[model samples]
Target: MATIRERAGRWQAIIKRKGYPQQSKTFDIKKDAEKWARQEERAMDAGTWADQSAAMQTTLAEALVRYEKEVTSGKKGADTERVRITKWKRHKLAQKALGTLKASDFAGYRDARLKDGAAAATVRLELAIISNLFNVARKEWSFEGLANPIEAMRLPTSKNARNRLFLDGEEARLLQALAPAARGEDGRFGDGCANPLLRPLVQLALATAMRRGELLALRWENIRLADRVAHLTDTKNGHSRDVPLSSAAAEVLRALPRAIRGPVFPITPNAVKLGFVRAVERARKRYEAEGGKDERMLSDLHFHDLRHIAVTALAEKLPNIVELAAVSGHQDVRMLRRYYHPKAEDLARKLG
Candidate 1:
């Protein structure tokens, strides 16, 4: 049996049936309430009814908090996921009940984000977190009737692949800018960064093609200079691989005084990002002072581009795609191709 009543300007539909718990829902109109009650009663009669009270009551923000504690905390990119979760919590959509969220809501969100100048990749990642959360809720949080809104959405196609490479004299200028600031004999301070690790960090990044997180998380005990191998127990893809270090990379490690057993870089990711940005600013200023007019030189350089630069250089030396993939820690050959951007002249030389 079903009951319909007006409660505070809204019609409430209540259903009671044998072998089932009480079910209720509120609608703006009496017709809607009656329609909902009839549907639920029929579904219950057919033994197809599932409780959706949790989904109806829980907000996206609440789900995100639980997801962060249980799922995001265990991820290697937990810090990054935390940032994403924080962003999600700030949005107006996060206040909506989980059961009320539909594919249209996220389609509008995607369009709105793109209009607001958010990158396709950023929006995709944000949506991915929600999608996974929905799946987790359905499987473990007793929201089996809740359909994943994001699964029905057409995700934004990402076209953000960067081919930015270092120009001649740019690397030298960058290294000089990252150099340790030392007092001269005349008591004048030279242009350089206060952090001594910046130069070697850039050098090693150019040599190894490792991700920034991998480099920052690097430990002293993992480096075997004799074998020219750096064992990475933790990586982005959750797979461990021993990265083969080049002579240049080994020299950088040898130059630094080895710690007993701690972080090799001993720098936070935020610190590295700020230091790199400052270093680039300094380098650009230095280049301008040296009568260089090339605006493109050292412009729009990112820390992650160093990995691309290293992979591209390694491709010339290694020649074998599989060998390059192993060194670069790429699980997919297609993804490895994204990093390997050889000059047309270089490829022509190899062809001849």
Candidate 2:
């Protein structure tokens, strides 16, 4: 039998059953309180009742901390995932207990994030982290009563695929901006980037369709110049592939002074990202100074766009889809199409 009573103008349901832990819940209505008590008592009698004490006690922040230490730390993108976890800790929703969170709460979060100018992809990733955390808790952390609130909510869809390509004279301006000043015999100066590696890095990215992470991870030991191949031991997809080097790509590598640190480009991701942004700004200024009329030239460019440009250019030479997929290391032909954006005029010329 369960006890139902009114306290502080609200009804409270308390169930004290033998051979099981006691359960109590407060409800606004007496009927709701009695209804909950009956259901809980019946479930206990049927041996179908699950204790949600752990989920009810644990907050989202606490769970995220545990997930980050035990799970996210072992992942390849651990640093990135940690950053996301930290962001979640700052949100008001993080204060709520895991069991108290509902699909409506997550839906509101998605709506608020979208209103605040957060990208659909970014929100999707954030929600995915929470969803996965719930799954891990249910499967491994002995929280079988906990439900994934995100599973009931529809995730925001992303349609932000970029097709950014370098315009006429834009590449030249960017390269010039990246180039460091030449030192004379008297220690005089001339035009280029202070870091000698930046130019070659950009050149190699354009020559080969290698991702920024792939380029940064490139090692001299993996290069077989005679065979014109760069062996990648690790890739985004967890599969290794040999990237064939073009004459231009080979020349860029040959000119670079070998680093004793092992990595071909010893720069960190943040360094490359910051350096690329500064170089683009400088290029834009120089382009305008040279009477370049197009406002879009060298504007809104990203380092990752280089991979897309390289893929599109490679499509011209390797017309066969299979051969192009081999070069780009794209396991799916559909994904390859996303990167290969050929100009209509070029296609028309080829048709002629």
Candidate 3:
């Protein structure tokens, strides 16, 4: 049976049914209430009515906290989820309860987020986090009949093309700036001094094209200097991969003192980011001092861009660009293409 009640100047329909927890929803019209109740009844009879209240009772923030602690914390690459959770906490979707969130609510949130200058990629990521949370709720947390609202929603196309890469001269200049900073006097830089890891980090990124997380998680045992290969224990696709080390890359690894404890790159992810920031600052200052335009020298250079440089170099060296895709650990050729660039000689030959 379903009854209509007036509360908070809104018409709320309260339904009582077997196996269905008591459910209520506010509607503007009595007919709408009747229509929804009939639909719900059919769904309930078919054993398809997901307990919306069970899902809705948990707020997005609360769900994320639980997911982070119980689910993400157990994973090997859990830091990425932690970063996503931080972003979600600041998003409007985090304020809403999962049960009360209709498809329209998500649509509005998506639209509003776009209006507020969030990129399609960012919105898509937030949606993914939400969807994953609900999935965990249903499968792990015993929240029955909880439909993922995001399933009914379509996210905009993500702009994920790699537009940033180091040009020939750019890499040389960056290395020249980073080398002295990385190998400072006495092999250890003083506090407030330049990062001691910048050159080696850049070299590894350019040679291997490994993701930042993958690089940071590398262990000393994984680096086989004698074998000339670095065994990556796990990658983004949840597979173990072996990346061959270039001569220069091997030299960089040999130069590094073994970590006393865990990861080869023992610094926290935040520390890596901070080190990158400091390196960028130093590079910018040097560029300006040498009479270069501040904007031109610093234009669109990110730590991740070094991976693009590696992939591009490898693609140009081989006749089949697809061969390098395996080395770069890209599952798809389409993804590999984003980082591939034609060699200048090849371009010249084509022009001729």
> What are the Cα lDDT values of the candidates?
0.90, 0.88, 0.76
Candidate 2, residues 289-319, lDDT tens digits: the string is 8788898998889998999999999998987
> Per-candidate TM vs. native?
0.86, 0.82, 0.78
Select the stronger candidate by TM-score from 2 and 3. 2
Write one digit per residue (lDDT tens) for candidate 1, span 1-352.
Answer: 7999999999999887778879988899899999999898888878888888899999999999999999999987788889889989999999999999999999999999999998898899999999999999999999968999999989999996987889988898899899998888987767788789988999999999999999988899998989999999899888989999988999999999799799999887777888999999999988898898999987989898898888989998887789999999988998877656668897799999
Q: Can you write out model 3's per-residue Cα lDDT over 32-123, one digit (the tens) per residue?
A: 88788878888888877776665767888888899999988987657766987888777777788877677777788789889999879878
- Ranked candidates (TM-score, high to low): 1, 2, 3
Best by TM-score: 1
Q: What is the lDDT, from 0 to 100, of the residue 156 in candidate 2?
A: 96
Model 1's alpha-carbon lDDT is 0.90
Clashes of each: 0, 5, 2
Q: Candidate 1, residue 348: CA error in Å? A: 13
Query: Where is model 2 more than 4 Å wrong at Cα?
Result: 5-12, 26-32, 45-47, 180-199, 285-293, 338-352
RMSD of each: 4.1, 4.7, 4.9
Identify the runs in model 3 with alpha carbons over 4 angstroms from their true place.
3-14, 17-47, 108-119, 167-169, 176-194, 259-261, 294-296, 320-323, 332-352
Model 2 poorest 10 in a row by lDDT: 187-196
